[model samples]
Target: MLIGAEAVDTAVELNAYLARFGYGQGLSIQQLWAEMDRVWAEMGLDNRRPLGSQRIADFYAHPVWVLNGLFADTDPTSVRHRQAIAAFLKDACDDQARLRIADYGGGSGALARQIVDRLPGRSQIDLIEPFPSDFFRRRLGYRSEIRFHDVLSSDGYDVVIAQDVLEHVEQPIALAQRCIDATRQGGLVLFANCFYPCIQCHLPGTFYLRHTFRYVLASPALSYVGAVPGAAHVLIFRKHGEIDVAALVRRDRIARGVGPLLNLLGQFHSQMKTLGRRAGLSE
Candidate 1:
């Protein structure tokens, strides 16, 4: 497994960091997990209701996400995932004299900072987060290698990462296109999407893309580079140039045609697993 000692330590210290942000006041992990649902209920957010773009943007600015983000990033699975991302990045750009990376919807900037330390070449990372937590600004603010951006810059980046970001957006396709658009030709776009309804915040609208994301986002301009080793969720792709609109439309049609069967099988599997547990067949 690809490991970043410093990043792991930083994630381990998130609970202490949260203390400064007015969280972790005798709060347990379970309570912190429930915080997002609690906020959703307080806001009267209906999962069935689709939020407008601005509303979605504003909702993400809430402080509850800081707690959620800290825990999520610190989880063992997430730490490994970031390690995989860093490994792929290193393999792709290690030989280059300079590297430019953009981490879209990157919550804590931990991954970007970790990359800074691991890469030998001079590198710059732009963290595209609309509402960076106070801890993030305070902890990484002095790092000359990492810069925070509320909006993605038009500059062509050598690598663009959007890990677990598309599921929260109203128009994931639009954002996915933007990720592709921002990359330099032959540069990499790394994506780790969770399109399934695994969490309350993952919009139901995106569930259609759960099985179809790769096909839907397929473009002639983007050559499929395969998934990151040991972390299958994170996909690797190399950009060739401007996206072909006709090819995109065709691929979207293909996804729409094929995704429902996969979704149905997935639902059936979940239902059967739930039934099995209820009958005490398995844990």
Candidate 2:
């Protein structure tokens, strides 16, 4: 929804703009959709419905979504998205001679490329995406420093990036814990562009707030850095020593119990607002 510059004077300027952030090269949404249509025709598939109508199952089963760039387009790409990511990267990669970075649920390896470009020294990066497109994989093959993984490794890293991933998962706390566990002591964990509603497979409004992520930061294992809230909020956490597993489990239990009640309340409020608007009693 956050569109960037619609027009550029020259290809050179556009390429430089993209390269400044290590985006490498990518097609416009129009071009991406055109390619998707071709792929759909070739596969003899015809699901032309809007994104909101598409279910989570369809997203995973169809390569058209991931391979043709629909999945890539869902990421927040506004000026705010770039600024937040840049600020986090500056702090996380500062004064590092060598770094190991993990991008959890990294789609198309965009963030991995950014990390490699931003960091000053030798870096090893891993992109953990469960449903990566062969197209994207081949595109990223030239970067020997970046490796793709279907599952997260048990090994620790200096920085872990889980951008816009929590809202999609069934159990956010579990996923957050995995990111924390993979980070070394005093290492940074970036959670940017998260807690936003998406067309497919996002948690309810009750769990899409800054407080919902507090459970992870409250753990003995992590220290809160800061947050920048916008259409997509960015939250940063730093790992301490080993996590207090028992405390984390207890917090998750509480969240699960309270989440549904909060969701119901939110739904009630939304319905009331809609009714009021129809009655011309509210703006």
Backbone clash numbers for all candidates listed: 0, 0
lDDT of 2 at 20: 42
Stretches of candidate 1 off by over 4 Å are 1-32, 53-58, 269-283
> Candidate 1 has which clashing residue pairs, if any?
none
Query: What is residue 230's positional error in candidate 2, in angstroms?
Result: 8.4
**Prediction RMSDs, each to the true structure:** 7.5, 10.0
lDDT of 2 by residue, 1-283 (tens): 5434543343345345444433423445455446544544554432333334445444543554443233353444543464456456666567777888888877567666665666634678888887765556777899988898988876889888887677766667778788888998889887764453433234453263334457535866688877744324667788888888888878777766765666568779989998988889644
* Every candidate's lDDT: 0.78, 0.64
lDDT of 1 by residue, 1-283 (tens): 7759986776667556567545544455567657767667677776678675225554566666776666555566666777877877788787788899999988588688668878844789999997776567767878888888888876899999998888888778778888888999989998888887655788877777888888877767888899998799898999998998777877766776777778999899999998988889654
Each candidate structure's TM-score, on Cα atoms with residue i matched to residue i, is 0.81, 0.66
Give the range where candidate 2 is weakest over 10 consecutive residues by summed lDDT. 45-54
